[model samples]
Target: MYQCEHGGVVRLKLAVDPDLGPLAAELSSLARGAGLDAVGITGAEPFGSTRRHLEQRKAAGLHGGMHFTYGDPARSTDPDRALPGARALVVGARSYRRAAPAPPRGNGVYGQVARYSWSDHYGPLRDGLGVVARHLEANGWQARVLVDDNAMVDREAAHRAGLGWYGKNTALLLPGKGSWFVLGSVVTDAPLPPTTASAAGGCGSCARCLPACPTGALVEPGVLDARRCLAWLLQAPGTFPIDLRPALGGRIYGCDDCQEVCPPNRTEDRRHPPPPAGDEDEPWVELVRLLERTDAELLAHLGRWYIPRRQPRYLRRNALVALGNVGDGGDGRVVRALVDGLAAGDPLLRAHAVWAAARLGRGDLVAGLAASETDPEVRTELAAAGLTG
Candidate 1:
């Protein structure tokens, strides 16, 4: 009679094992001892609505530049593809949404980085899951832990395991823990029993997250249009649509506007602590500093926290878009940076720089860009940037 809470139409079974009780207890304690918020176990199965939503998101070209693993059904949805012998998944969640410090307005422009990007969740999550896997291995079971890059839909697994439910923003929302948590999982060949109950969310008519999106990316409950999603725009690897450039505002990296506006995440107690020192004080990361970060500087600051899957140039290009959105031609410092940035070898980098320079209304920048811009794509960007303001 038990069913997946989020994907209720799908039938699932709980393969209970007597030994799992102690192991679950041990994992709960281990996760907490290691600073994790919650952890649970579930069988390997397709997360009902996620597959449908992912297909729709991809079909609409909303995927932007991110070719998500799940975008391919054979590779992502099928548990057999990820691990031939996989039977159950051990899912874990952690809270990284800290209380943001107040922004010192007027003194400087602020840039918003998505909460997840602010820290490195993979290392700790992987390490903890590895420990959990080892514990299961000791009990005569085969275990393997995977992070965000893997094919499995982590939020779906966690929800089915009674860890949380999908929110209107498409994030996993736990009852008391809030939606600010990061997820981790350990897929194993062992036949561990599944949790008796699925995490049917208690959203209860609360549509707080639906209308908060600036781009209307969340078309309906639990659906996200990645094209309109500013987060995707920032992460896209190639030239962005010039029309949406202004809506990007001062966001140099990822956009937290949607999450920032989430009611569940707004609670004061659930907020994480402030950045320790020598970092952006509050409201958000600053835009001027984002535009100024060199490749090495960006890697040095964020490389440890973010997965180095794509080249760092993608992020630099995003910075250019942000700078163009906020930069005024009057600010000689930013203009010079944009001018200098256009000379870089990466076409994506050069292209975005052209756009930024144009937004700042620098005729000198256009001349300089014309002198060095060889890539046809960049030349197009230069022409577009020049026409913008």
Candidate 2:
């Protein structure tokens, strides 16, 4: 309690009790037992450095129409913007690093998904963070859980919490462990002990991740141009860019080349046994089946992904490109898909179909399509293929 003298009258100001007394250890212990691999705390001040970086990159056109925290850096960086009167953030990290699954058993054209998308890693991560948040709530503090959410800059919080340092690839690298973790946090009003200093440099001059990009997406250390990023390109709606289409290879979802080539990741994997697999998890999806899935079916399967406008055609668009990259040029299904897409009503599908068919040396099927196609976009696509009919 404090006394304030005003006009010769003494008034007492009662101090609010900080409920987190002696509870930090319990929070960390509960988080670890709840399945989180790394847990730490930090003050919930606005992430100034991160906000400036976001604003600067966005102004430079490096954001490439991509908007997450890039949408509004000021709001995203401030914990108060997410929750009023927030004082501390309890950050959590869970490893999604798993040995690559065995290649497809049968003869089927398939597209590889990034290891992170192999399953719902965020679900378990959220559960662990929930335990931490509830623990704070069970006491007398107001707490909120955020994971893979735009509410806060999770990596900055994690870094401040001494969880790890940012690798050249812009991923957080755990001390001995690699950058194979999914991050999240619990924002609370409790006055928890915050980590003093961030982890020191782990990537001493290793530039392997820089040249590892097949599409040259990594413009520099710790900076990425989303336009050139294959992961973002796949999620971006509209036609896949012509020049980068071939570089896509058989990647249907996210790209993991940078992480795969990271020396730390390779070393970390060798030390642990492969993570178990399940029928629900898919490291790769059959190209033909993906193209054939209906909107409902696509949602049922890939809804967790960041699909463009929640439409199935976008997935079909990506599958079509992957098919052109790896599908047998003469496979009946491949031929049929190309022909069907060429004859379809959607100009986006029709345009990509023209490219895929011609790419597969099925120039013969395009002649009839060129004659029947009336959409100016489809005509332009055919003209590009040298099909005048």
On lDDT, the leading prediction is: 2
RMSD of each: 6.9, 4.0
Relative to the true structure, candidate 1 reaches a TM of 0.82
Instruction: Specify the poorest-scoring 10-residue window by lDDT in model 2.
Output: 9-18
- lDDT string for model 2 (81-140, tens) is 887888888999998877677878887889999888988999999999999999888876
Clashes of each: 5, 0
- Supply the global lDDT for candidate 2: 0.85
- Score candidate 1 by lDDT: 0.69
- For candidate 1, the clash count comes to 5
Clashing pairs in 2: none
Candidate 1 clashing pairs? Answer: 15-193, 98-272, 99-272, 101-282, 103-283
Error of 1 at 75 (Å): 3.1
List the candidates' TM-scores in order.
Answer: 0.82, 0.93
1-389: candidate 1 lDDT, tens digit per residue: 23466855432233555556777778667866776778887887656566776677677766654675545744666565677767788888877766655555674556666666665666777887888888878866677777885587777778878897777788888876577777878887665777655545566787777788777778888777777887777766567777787788876556676666666666534464434423432336555675577768867766653332546776666667777777677876776677767777778777777777767776666675587656889777767655322
